[model samples]
Target: MLRADVRAARKRLTGRIRTTPVFHTSVNGPNGQVPVTLKLEYLQHGGTFKVRGSLNAMLAADPAADRVIIASGGNAGIAAALAAAALGISCTVVVPESAPHTKVAAMWSHGAEVLWHGTTYAEAHRYATDLAAERNALPLHAFDLPAVVAGVGVVGLELEEQVRGRPPILVAVGGGGLMAGIAAALGRRRQVIGVEPEGMPILRAALSADRPVEVGASGLVADGLWASRIGDIALDVARRYGVRSVLVSDDAIAAARDYLWREFRIVVELAGAAALAAVQSGVYAPPAGERPVIVLCGANAELGG
Candidate 1:
């Protein structure tokens, strides 16, 4: 089911979006990985890879769509807002009060009517989902939707085409949409590692217990990882497919953020750091001579934006 959806998603998003760059980063890490491919999706439009899903969602919707609404921690909202602006459609985004100001500003700058509701992404999602139903508007979910996940799978398409045949693995699991979609795109040929923050171990707990359990932990990375529950669609993808989950420390993620800035000069947010954290902390180490890949998904971190 997911594979079919992903194929349709790829066809739906062929030239609608830019295939972000994937690179073999040769820099110093906390560990001694000679070269790990880094999919610089941080360089995605609107400052994150979220544009892929947003544009795909918009394309999947009817052209005469009355309105669109979305709930997000930050990156997804910004992506949706930008897409709406391009299409000249009315978009209202529900965000949590806890979301960083930079993310809020990014959405507002794209002419999205921003609504601060609830205390976290899950709460905001509930509000936004209900509100969309009331208005008969399209609800652009942050990650749960098949369209959204398939849109994210485009990242895998780009990686596979760019990195020869059969890349080692992909490490980027927040909201699980990114991993689920990418895993679907790559099929069972490549390893898709689900990396999550230790503070908010959504996938780790889910894979361990073999079911989606709620253990919501709050952090700056909440926008990326504080999803109270896993997406049933995405979780089912991981289960039916072969997706491995790993947990990384918040401190390791912080160090990764700093390392990327100092080493690669790439100023990415905590979300992008999660993948690197998995590799550096030995939580999901690659086999000998196996070329591992990390998808640097989004970069919306700001100290005081």
Candidate 2:
């Protein structure tokens, strides 16, 4: 995926997706008060940026297909369901048994046939692929295809238009699709920092190995960042665009999520808070006079009344 591909995706998704807002504010980081820009993509349709990729993949592929199958920990399944519904297609989502109840319920509400299988997203992905092959249904991956990554690049395209000077961007990483798309969209102009949970450091491990490597997934934030390996496309883009990787502890992620709620009244899932955790915990501190942008990428949490 590249900037041109991303621009084409934006044109295709002109009215199908939303142009989420951006908020500029100051927050007390470990260093001191820091000015930051927040890309409020958590408020996106299906409660996450995955909707962009899901919708784009379906639209770019065979829109006349009647049935589609997808596997996700939560957010991607909700996105696939939403996209399938919009395209008037039947969708079956296979998710790990441990996926959050709220996300599963949202998928069901979107008219998807929800199936629970295995305990990890990798296992569920295998099952979903097999089922799709057997049923002759179109299969949608969470974050690996060209159309999907190109669609996700729209986020960075919007960020470039919304923020000035091409500041560094902090985004949470799962399979590395979001980070890759953003990096491809920016074309090595701006820095893109990928944040991941310490326990499930898929991108970090891949960077260390100079290839996409499988990692054990276990963390408080694993519900959203459970990909065992980074996608090949993400690794290629990261290598080409100098994408940086950082890790944050589960405790830091929890604290960051709570801080957003208390200070900004923002409700985000643990994964959504990972990038902020990198900033708040001083894991990826910016240089002096460098303003950074943090992306709140998902809001699939079960907010109690």
Candidate 3:
């Protein structure tokens, strides 16, 4: 059912979004001589990859689904709101206290009612779940559903089309949605790696503990990467597909972001910079005779840089 659903999502998502391009980046990392392919997904409209899954969820679920509700730290909410607006449906997003004012404003700008829940994502999710049930709204999961995962997989499928062969390494992670989609899309391929910030190693910690444990959010990348726990759906997909997880630090991510601005002349958010941090900081050193790919997932940033 999940596989079929994902396929349907891919079909539904076609022509609805831009398939961002991939280019071999020349940035030198601590890991010796390895060419890197950058999956420039930030070029996609809505300024991030969230639109893929948001649109997919909206299209796949009951179109008659009145009042869609979602829980998000930010990006997903904006995506949900945009999707709902396009579909002519209403949406409400519950966000954590830590969610930036900019994000809440963005959600509101897209026509989503923003409610501040507790201090963390889990608490917000619970509140959103209750509100969704109470309002008789259909829930659009932030991450962790076959439809959502498949929509994200479109990024991977497009990457595969661009690369056409094993790239030796590819990296991405979020609330585990992007990684789950990439992993399922790449199935059994050992090179696609999932990278997370040290403080929000929901997926990595899950791999170590063999279960998803609540890890309070911390780090610059905390905005998008830190979910108290990995999505149960994401964890299952990851574990079943043998995806590897690694952690990088806030400092490394900052440097990576600076590097992108300085060298590549690109703008990306903290969560979007993790894979670059992993390589440059030696958090994820590539093996000899292997290539690497970094998923530049988003660019939801404060303007006037």
Candidate 4:
């Protein structure tokens, strides 16, 4: 999508979505403390940035459509459910059996019909599509659609206003919807980096192969970042905007999560800490005097004692 499309999405999302706050902080670097900003998008409605795209897509669709169907491991399902609830539309979310119980419960709380279909997101997606066809319901992809991508691009616009210089923004990727929106919105104005799990390096593998490819998704954050293939629109936007990828191990991700809670009193899901893990683990080193922005993408974890 283009900047104009993102702008339109932003306008449509004005009051519907939360303008998630950005926390200005510094992270220890090779030299010293390097300035950084954390976009606390995990605090958004449904505990993820996915709601932005979900709301935008639903707003543009026919209002007469009674139901909307989508397949998600967690965050996207919650997003669609929340959006559907806001618009008074029925929502059906098909999630993998491995999805977190807290997320499924949240969808149920939103009055959605939830189904456990398979072990992987791809399988759940197939079932969701078939069910939508059978019911003649509107179907929504977690990522890949123009409206969804454009809707997510609003985060970049908000960041531009929240920070001083155009710093590189580190985003955790699942299906690459959020990354594509931010990259297309910012264009060449700022650098965009995609952080993925080492096992599920969807964007990295796709970039290397010069096309979208399926990769195995198995890790601590698999439920949240478990898209086997990056979306086609995301890949195209990444190429056009020079989006780079960084891989982080599950151990590093866990460490990052602990560090956030210990230092900043921030508790987030494993996928939420992936971008910070890249910096803390030294996988994606930032140059001296360079300030980067990291996006904490989701907060759908069960906080148990």
Candidate 5:
């Protein structure tokens, strides 16, 4: 998707979603305290940034369509359900058994018909695709579609106004939709770094292979970051924009989550902390004077003390 498409998506979702805030802070790094900006997108509606794309896609579709179907690990399904609720359409979300109960409950609370299928998101997606055809429901992909990718690109546009200079952006990737959108929107204006769980480095693997390839998903944040393969559309955008990928360990991800809560009193899911983990763990280091912006993408998982 192009920058113009992202602007059109922003127009379509003007009043539907929240323009989340950005906060500046100094984080303890291998060298010293590294200054950084955190885009607080976890505060977004449906408890994640997925709502931006979900709302935009639903709005662009025919209003007369009664049913919409999607498969998600968690965040995207909740976003789709909330969007469908707002549009007064029926939504059915098929999620893998490994999905967090908190997310499934949130979808149910949003009035969506929830189905538990398969052990992994990829398996659930296959089931959802078949069900969508059987039900004749308008299928909404969690990522990979042009409209969804364009809608997510709006985050980059918002950041342009929020950040003073074009700072390198670190974003967590699952299916690569959010990273692709941001890369497309920013378009070489800023460096886009994609972070993923070491165990589920779908985008990293895809980039290395020069195409989408299946990867095993086994990590603390598997539910959110577990995509067997990166989407084709996302891969194309990443290649076009020269986006780079990094891998973070589950240990680092857990530490980042704890650090966010202990230091900033901010709570985020495992996937949400992946980007920060890259910096905190020294996997993706920035220049001494450069202050990179990290996108805190979601907080949909259950909070435990």
Candidate 6:
């Protein structure tokens, strides 16, 4: 998607979604403690950035369409359900069995007909696609459509205007939609670095292979970043924009999650903490004098007492 598309999405999504706030904070960087900007996307509707795309897609869908369907690991399904409910349309979400119960319950609370199938998101996605065809319903992809990516690009537009000066951005990648959208929005003006869990480095693997390929997804945060393969649209945008990819270990992710909770009182999920883990673990060291921004992508974790 182009910058123009992102701008149009911003206008279309006006009053429909919240412009998540950005907070300045100090984190343990590679060279001792350093300042960083945190985009609190976890506070977004549906508790994730997925709402932007899902809502935009629904708005652009045919008015005659009465039903929507999607398959997600968790956050995206919740987004679709919320959007469908707001639009007064019927929605059915099919999630993998591994999806967290809290997420499924959230979808149900949002008035979506939820179903569980398969062991992985890919399998669930296939089932959802077939079901959509059978039901003649519009299918909303989690991160692989032009409108969805363009909708997500609005985050980059907001960040560019919010942050002082042009700073490199670190974003956690799942199917690579968020990274691609941000990179497309910023173009070559700012660096967009994608962070992935070591156990589910689909974007990193796709970048190395110069194409999307299937990879195993298993780790502390697999539920959010468990896409078996990166989307073709995301890969193409990353290549065109020269987006950098880094992988962080599960230990580092857990540590980063704890740090955010203890130090910042930010209860973000593992996927949201992955970007911070890159800096905290020295996996992605920023250049001296260059300020970096980290996108806290989600906050759907169950924090128990």
- What is the overall TM-score of model 2 with all chains considered together? 0.96
**Tens digits of per-residue lDDT for model 4, 109-211:** 9999999998889999999999999999999999988999999899999998998887899999989999999999999999999999898999999999999
Worst 10 residues of 1 by lDDT: 217-226
Q: Model 5 Cα displacement at 13 (Å)?
A: 0.6
Q: For candidate 3, write residues 1-305 as lDDT tens digits.
A: 14455567778988888989888766768845456788898887777788899888878886567688999887888888888888888999998888877777888888888888887777888898999899999888888766777888777777767885676444657788888877777676545678888877788888888888877677565553257788887888778887888788888888988899998889988778888888888877766655688888888876653
Local distance difference test, candidate 2 = 0.89
How high is each candidate's TM-score? 0.93, 0.96, 0.92, 0.96, 0.96, 0.96
Q: Write the per-residue lDDT of candidate 5 for residues 178-220, one digit (tens) a residue.
A: 9989998889999999998888888888889999999876766
Q: What lDDT does each candidate get?
A: 0.79, 0.89, 0.79, 0.90, 0.89, 0.89
> Residue 5 of model 2: what lDDT?
87
Candidate 3 has what TM-score? Answer: 0.92
Residue 98 deviation, candidate 6, in Å?
Answer: 1.3
Across 81-184, the per-residue lDDT of candidate 1 in tens digits comes to: 99889878899999888877888999999999999998878788889999999999999888888778888788877787788757566566667788888888
lDDT of 2 by residue, 1-305 (tens): 67898888888899999999999997778978888889999999988999999888888886456889999988999999999999899999998888888889999999999999998888899999999999999899999988889998899999998999979999999888899889999987899999988988888788899988988767675553388899999999998888878999999999989989999999998889999999888988778878899999999987671
lDDT of candidate 6 over 1-305, digit per residue (tens): 78887888888899999999999878986679977899999999989999999888888876656899999988899999998999899999999988888889999999999998898888899999999999999999999988888888899999999998989999999888889888888899899999998898888888899999998767775553378899998999899989978999999998999999999898988889999999999988777777799999999987571
RMSD of each: 2.0, 1.6, 2.1, 1.6, 1.4, 1.5
Task: Give each model's clash number.
Answer: 0, 0, 0, 0, 0, 0
lDDT of 4: 0.90
The C-alpha stretches of model 1 lying farther than 4 A from their native spots are 29-31, 62-64, 218-225
Instruction: Check candidate 6 and list the clashing pairs.
Output: none
On the 0 to 100 scale, the lDDT of residue 88 in model 6 is 94
What lDDT score is found at residue 194 in candidate 5? 95
Residue 60 displacement in candidate 3 (angstroms): 0.8
